[model samples]
Target chain A: MGNLRERLKAFYADYSFYILPVMKFALALGIYVLINNRLGYMEALNRLFILVILAAISAILPFNATVMIGIALIVAHCFGLGVETGLFALVLYVVLVLLYFRFVPRDALVMLMTPVAGILHMEAVVPLCLGLVRGPESALSAACGLVSWQFVEIVHDEIAPLKEADAGMLNVLQSIPASLFSPKLLLCVIASAAATVLVALIVRHMTTYTRLRAVIAGAVLYLVIMLAGGVAVGVELNAPAIVAGTAASAAVALFLNMFVYSVDYRQSRFIQFEDDDYYYYVKAIPKMRAGGAKPVRYYDDSSRQNGTGTPVNGQDVDGVDFKTKLEDSLKDL
Target chain B: MLTKQRLQLMISLADFKQSHINTTMRVTKYYRNDYVAVQLVKNFFVTSIAYLILLGFFAVYHLDFLLTNMNNLKMGRLAAVLLIIYLVMLAVYSVITYVIARIRYARAREKAEDYDQKLDLLANIYREEKQSSGNPFGEDQ
Candidate 1:
């Protein structure tokens, strides 16, 4: 035991930085995957894809609706639904998000969304999905996991039980089932399509709004095709039909975006825009190297300076950073 | 807290030593023991928080699952295996964070050293040029 400990200690002394972090990241991802696979089948793959698109684009869609969704998830579980409350909540969520985007400046929205994406929601994402799909126990556990991606397990289990239960209760579950009269489904489809446009508009305002509204306007116009498809499918404004259609809209959105976000699965590396701000911390290291190694010297009337762009020995050659010294000295002539 | 502050003081002392060429003393000795204790404590915070979230999940699941499943071979065995795996992972993560922090601190010290070295060299050149130029407005001119 003592000999093994000594050997392990020696290995750690050498390659702890690279080896250790990779191991931790692997462990975290492994644990999430293990739990997710076992729980199985979230049922609404189309809707799930739609949700991801909504999430990706809605990252900027200025809707005050975040609070409503936060409230809706809680209320949907609690109230279960009565009359048209499902539709009411769906509309409310949209209005809330729209209000948030309208009232807040774009920069502030980005700032707020950064934390929403980066810190508060980091691992909590999967856990929140678990809460959506699992029992109260699993939901609590998921909340604890925080920023987890373990929803498939919990969702599969929840949907299995709902399958045996009848249709009226499903309507009470809202456009959740995709049948008809699912105000929630109608709302989600409408809002998601609008969000794609709204996001394009907000992004257009970035650095210079190049009036590309024509392209995005064409995309939003495709909702007419979806609406026509819904009518042709003979889906009536009934509870079961609405719930089913809601799920269908999600599926369609997913299918379309599969080509839209369209990442080539072949690429081994993808940059997560989330928490990319910290990327500069590491990036600065290379730039410092690129600027060269030595104290850059030049013929000056008075004193010499270093090349790093910083003053040294409490002295500066004509009040310039050492790195900038050579350039400035050249320009001086 | 005192230990951490002292370790920080030593690191900053190292920082001062590496950055300021006027001080020509050996500082690598003063830092040796103090850093070890600080590194261990820092590792504890990391491992403990990681272990905290995992153990909290188990505690939520049930404390009695351990005693009750002491005999059941399938799920119980899985639970035990996962627990052991998680703890081992925790220790690995703790050590990883420790090393990254160490590398960053060392690299910063290296940058300060490189900077101070350049400044010292430049200062020497200035002193030499001034000596040769004979004070520009003085008797030698």
Candidate 2:
């Protein structure tokens, strides 16, 4: 009974950080489907994959303000769709995020990444793994499983009707000839970008330089690929390519980074880095210091006693005398 | 099920906020020795003023372009409808964060009312001082 209780506790502990985010992801998706039966499948699918992976990361790391923000902002940024489509999506994302850290378990890294994670959804790898994992399963099964979670169920039962009414209200709002753009929308974008920077600053507080470097490198690569694709496809930076390119770039960087780590890590720690059919430059050094590998046999003294050879201390040394000393030290006891 | 963990998490957040504020106060005090603090405040003031001016200026500058864009989109009334919906959503998100943060602050104040481990450490420091010099005050000596 005690063991069973402990198992249950562990299970809850493991998944606590993710439950709310995943549920929110589903709620946002459900609303998307309701609004348009033929919802652009690319962005929603990509977001679904990322949601699962980040869910895993959040589960592993300790919960904190940083991680919560990271988790929330990312889910919102990805699935919220375009700027226009994102308005409602963003609200659901924020509420779910708040509820998670409030009502669920948050890991330490989540706390560190909280600020920027939401707006930017900075971790690019979420989609890559999700693609590899979820692509095999039926979309309906995946969607339903996600939607059935407690948070999604709550939204369906409680929030959906209210939102449906809002949708009707939004329809009425359409009749007005008001400007398409408003300071409100522009401010929101600027605010989100600022939030992205803010979250990144907070992330820098907890994460190491190398990981941070990888993150930035991944970002640049993602943008380049996305821009190239956007130009090629004549689509203005769509979700499918952005997510696909970013995920691919991050995976490549994660692999190549092994080659960039310090030699001491390779030698002492014994973590084998694979770059098959590749050769790397190694600098020859005179001595091993600070966790470096000790040289095999570099300590033989050439100076020895010649009865005439002068020594700084008491004894004089010559070549043969040095050889004798070496031999003597090496002799078996 | 979430009750126990929730309480622990909230208390932890309160502890974190208090320590962070204290650290910020100490660092700011020390940093005041440098002229950077003066520069920082001046820069903040200048930026805020600049942003305020631009906020009004840009509101008028882009107002025409935005309305035209809205008029161009032929999505019936949905386009205009969604814009209002977006504003309402933003308002909701902002209100929720502000209220929760305020509530957390109140909870933090209540948590601080109990005896803190900081007091015990300070008492130890006082005791050590008493041993070095026979009590400095005469009333209880």
**lDDT by residue (tens digit), candidate 1, A1-333:** 323433444454445545445544443333223322333232332233433433433334323233222233322432232333333334333332332222222212221222132222122122222222222233222221211111221123343355446445433333332322244334323433343344344333322222233223323333443355457655333444433443443343333333322211121111221121232111101112222232444445254434433222222234335667668769979
Whole-model lDDT per candidate: 0.36, 0.37
Where model 2 places Cα greater than 4 Å from the true spot, the runs are A6-40, A44-53, A60-83, A91-333, B1-122, B125-141
- TM-score of each candidate structure, all chains considered together: 0.26, 0.24
* Candidate 2 second chain TM: 0.34
Report fnat for all candidates as fractions from 0 to 1: 0.00, 0.00
For model 2, state the Cα shift of residue A216 in Å: 52
In terms of docking quality, model 1 is: incorrect
What digit string (tens of lDDT, one per residue) describes model 2 on residues A1-333? 323434433444455445555545443443333222222323444455554555455544434532453434433432433332233334334433333323223222322222212223333332222222223222222221122222222233333443446554343223111322333223323322332333244333333343445345435544554455456646444466556545554555344333322122211111111122333232212222212222222122443332343232221122234566568769965
How accurate locally is residue A153 in candidate 1, as Cα lDDT from 0 to 100? Answer: 18
RMSD of each: 22.7, 25.4
